[model samples]
Target: MEWHQPPAALVRTMNVVLRGVLPSPLGRGVGEFMLLAFTGRRTGQRYRVPVTAHRVAGDLCALTPAGWRLNFRGGADVDVTLAGRTTPMRGVLVEDRAEVARIYLDRMTELGMRRAARMIGLKFPLGRLPALDEVAELARREHFGVVRLSVRT
Candidate 1:
């Protein structure tokens, strides 16, 4: 399916809602939610966006079909609010297709075999999951952007 950006107003609303709840005790149980704060490329102003983050190999990763990843073309300092705690982190854009595929597959696997497969545009036998190599190929072909964030100790 073709990806369409959500309306800006809706995105802003989401950010507001997520920010209000994510730091609360109730929001602490939402494992996948996080607040990613970074500077806008052109405006040089700070912007925070809510994302569904996946932990991979001790790093936080987010897959966005949106252009926000462009702000970290090389790497950017960021603050991530996760589970009611905010920490300093370095956000790196993973441009290598192979690495992107690996991360994507890892996240999908975490999300659930069947759901992840379907989200990645894969159709397989009802009970079977695609191999990692297949997922990598599909991810490379589709050009998904992966933003990997490492905590700055």
Candidate 2:
């Protein structure tokens, strides 16, 4: 899917809410942005899921692991909410390993997933997930997938 830039006003609001309220008032961890809400393809109901965001060639991109396939795969017309505003988004499934890794690694490193997981009483599956070289292979063997959201301007 093509990428769409978020409006300047929305970015400003996100900086304030994400940096201000989310961390202090809500006591949430930092480096977290993008809350995606979509109508389940099967259920036709709303479901909201939080994701880490990154700037990929000037457009915001959300990364997802194979674990999220249950919620993201085949989903369409996703609604992305940042700060307090909601925007219409088109969901496109992505399966390229290098591309997926580029964004996934960026998110994990930025968010310090290993450390954050510890804080949240979760364990990191050190190397259990597919290795970089085997990403594409694993994706094909299993059902690895991601849904990229392109917000409509």
Best by lDDT: 1
What stretches of model 1 exceed 4 Å from their correct place? 1-13, 114-128, 131-142
lDDT of 1 by residue, 1-153 (tens): 122345689878878999888777766786668888899888899988878777778877878766788887788988988888888999989888788777776766666756554343344544555567876766655567889899876
Error of 1 at 34 (Å): 0.5
Cα lDDT tens digits, model 2, 31-150, are 446666677666777765655555555565664443544555554677766544557887776656667655443444445645434321223455333345554443345443456777
The Cα error of candidate 2 at residue 20, in Å, is: 15
Per-prediction RMSD in angstroms? 3.8, 10.6
Candidate 2: where is the Cα deviation over 4 Å?
1-31, 66-75, 106-145
Residues forming the 10-long window of minimal summed lDDT in candidate 2: 115-124
What TM-scores do the predictions have?
0.74, 0.51
